[model samples]
Target: MKFTRTANANWKGTGMEGTGTISTQSTTLNNAQLSFKTRFAEGVGTNPEELIAAAHSGCFTMQLSFLLTEAGFIPEDLNTKAKVTLEDGTITLIQLELEGKVPGISEEQFQELAQKAKAICPISKLLNTEITLSTTLTA
Candidate 1:
């Protein structure tokens, strides 16, 4: 199966001084404000790296859930945080931290499944930067 999702960005003025708004098809971020200040420094509104982190975390969590179910484990909770590192105008790395509670699964099994999910998640595949994952399996 194939599908497409899109977001639109409208910008004005020069790169350093310009501001923009991003609207997604789902309207979850309708007309969200973004600008150079938001991207490079702490400011009001969102930025591209923040968006990518959200997407990666969500995607990896969902993929892990699927894999857990397929392996006959029911997950009580799966929390993931993605950290995107941008350096010198390039995305250097993405680190995924996962805390999971799955009944009847060993820590090793959980770690293995999380690794598989990280490698196979759509967002992980789409990114061209180094990806590292740390997993915590809890009761």
Candidate 2:
């Protein structure tokens, strides 16, 4: 199976003063505003790192759910937070913190699946930076 996703960005003005809009094929983001302030100075808009974090968190959670089901365990819930660190105009690190509950699975097994999901998730594999995972498994 093959899948493709697309997003478009339109920007006007200079880097320091420029403002832009971002849109996705799914329309999850439609004309979302972005600016230098948003990326660097906590402005009132979305930024690339924030988008990356969202994508990573969603992808990792879904992958873990599939892994748990494949292992004969029913997944109750999976909550993940992905933190993207941008430094000196470079994306340096991404940390994934996951908390999950699944019936009939030990912590060791859950952690193993979490690690696998982190490694194989499409966004994780696409990123060229350090990735770390912290997982908490609950009964």
The C-alpha RMSD in Å for every predicted model, in order, reads 0.7, 0.9
lDDT of 2 by residue, 1-139 (tens): 9988899999999999989999999998999999999998887889999999999999999999998999999888899999999998899999999999898899889989999999999999999999999998886
Tens digit of lDDT per residue, candidate 1, span 13-112?
Answer: 9999999999999999999999999999989999999999999999999999999999999999999999999999999999999999999999889989
In order of appearance, the predictions have TM-scores of: 0.98, 0.96
Candidate 2 RMSD computed on C-alpha atoms after optimal superposition onto the true structure: 0.9
Off by over 4 Å in 2: none
Report the CA-based lDDT of candidate 1 relative to the real structure.
0.96
Candidate 1: stretches off by over 4 Å:
none
Backbone clash total for model 1 is 0
lDDT of each: 0.96, 0.93
